[model samples]
Target: MVEIRGGAATSLDDMVFEFLEYGEESSPESSFSSGDGCYDDDRDEERSFDVEESKAFWDEQMKLLQGTFYRTNSVESKIRQATKEVLKDAAYSSQCGCGRLRVEAGGGCRSCLRREVCNRLMNLGYDCAICKSKWRSSSSIPSGEHTYLEVVHRSNEKRGELRVVIELNFRAEFEMARASEEYNRLIGNLPEIFVGKTERLRGLIKILCSAAKRCMKEKNMHLGPWRKHKYMQAKWLGTCERSAPAPLPVGNAARPAKSKASMLTFDLSEAIPIPGLRRTAVEVGVI
Candidate 1:
């Protein structure tokens, strides 16, 4: 005979069997008298439901947080990449004639004079001092029939850096050539004294400056605002500014001149119609 003790622990199988037996043998009125079991069952179900809801809510929150983090990271990365690419290899070059005149009366051949002027202009950081003065005087500058200046942009890519060169077309040279007598006289004179004698050189200078200004405007239009945003975001994220190397003090004799990316600023309000020339003037100083 199997003996069962009162108030003893029961196995799952035993509990199931006892529950079934009680349900069958006990009267409904008697079962109702002990309401604690029903209440406990309801409480357990409520607890399970609450736990499930809390877990689901936390899971959703985590997903949203992760998504936001990823999106921010993606935008920052893109901006940084673009900024680096735009700044990496930016340069400009011009093929404007030197304001020096060459003629038989000057005892110099046109080809020799042209070469000398070009070489001198290149040495002077590709600036014609004479041209700058002319640009200041002119209301309207001439355009070139052929492109005279080139602006280069090299962008980083997986395959390689993509290079883009913009050639500026101006009408200055063509117009000067059309006025043959004045053009010939202007070229034959020495550049030092020739500045006051000719409008051709001035017109050419104005055109060159205009071309340079346009290039800078285009560059700023494309990248300036985007780069600013990237810089701000980097500053906020604590990824760049704090960790960046300190700038060398101006008075530190031991510090080497560090080359930085050139930032072009264009001031539309200037005596010369060409904007962004102040910085250029500094680089390509007057003759």
Candidate 2:
């Protein structure tokens, strides 16, 4: 079951969202662990992260999800992105407009014309006259502003359906580094590293979402190191969340061809795994 909090969403089918990175070079920088404690460490962070580090991390994550379909080319992806943008712009302007930039065409409010533009783009989807018109900005953030991205696969229309919202943890980058430490410690011994750690990764994800929410809402982007902050491990993030269901032990099945569009991905790919043909431990000739 894939999950995210906050408001942004995207969907694709045939493949689950392995992870998605928004900016350039998305394969090498993402540091991730499954249920493992890859970077758990005893030390506190003392260094500042590079501005590009986040981009690198996302790129790496996207690499992990390559060859999968997100239905991005479809109008759906455009719609979803537009929806989030509209909401974000509205929120930014309503909340004092730090994110709002220059106002060239939209309308009156010189104060938050930048925000108004975003709202307009979001409301209009890809039909935004600015994008097609290639309207120039007097002051675009030279360095791209930090943005949130989500990865998803198509949901079965046969089944009901779901909508996801994800919020990032401001401290996730540090936690990832720590998880890396744990991963290093247990290189030769996963069982030991994972002892009592079935859901460490999930807990970490929750913490990240909380941090991102706080940062976005306060309109301040201040962040903390990941390793120092401890996450609560005793609870599930919420019942509304759903993971990609699958065969008990193995991971997800391979995805179908992808064309970059919005889609819904399901974990249990068999649609209905055949009972008799189901591979069991004995079927592997292990028994």
lDDT of 1: 0.26
Q: Encode model 2's per-residue lDDT on 1-287: one tens digit a residue.
A: 24433211222211122122222221112222233534444211211243256444434433332322221233334434443445344433322233223232222233333334333543453222111001112232121112222223245677332222222222223232223322232221111101011123354444343433333323333333222222121122222222222222111123345655333654353556766665444443555
Ten contiguous residues minimizing lDDT sum, candidate 2: 189-198
Clashes of 1: 8
| True lDDT of residue 276, candidate 2 | 66
Task: Give all TM-scores, in the order shown.
Answer: 0.17, 0.23
Our model 2 lands, by Cα RMSD against the true structure, at 26.5
**Per-residue lDDT of candidate 1, residues 230-272 (tens digit):** 2222211111111111232223345567955433654444535
lDDT of each: 0.26, 0.29
Candidate 2 stretches with Cα past 4 Å from truth are 1-62, 66-79, 91-157, 168-237, 240-287
lDDT score for residue 94 of model 1:
16
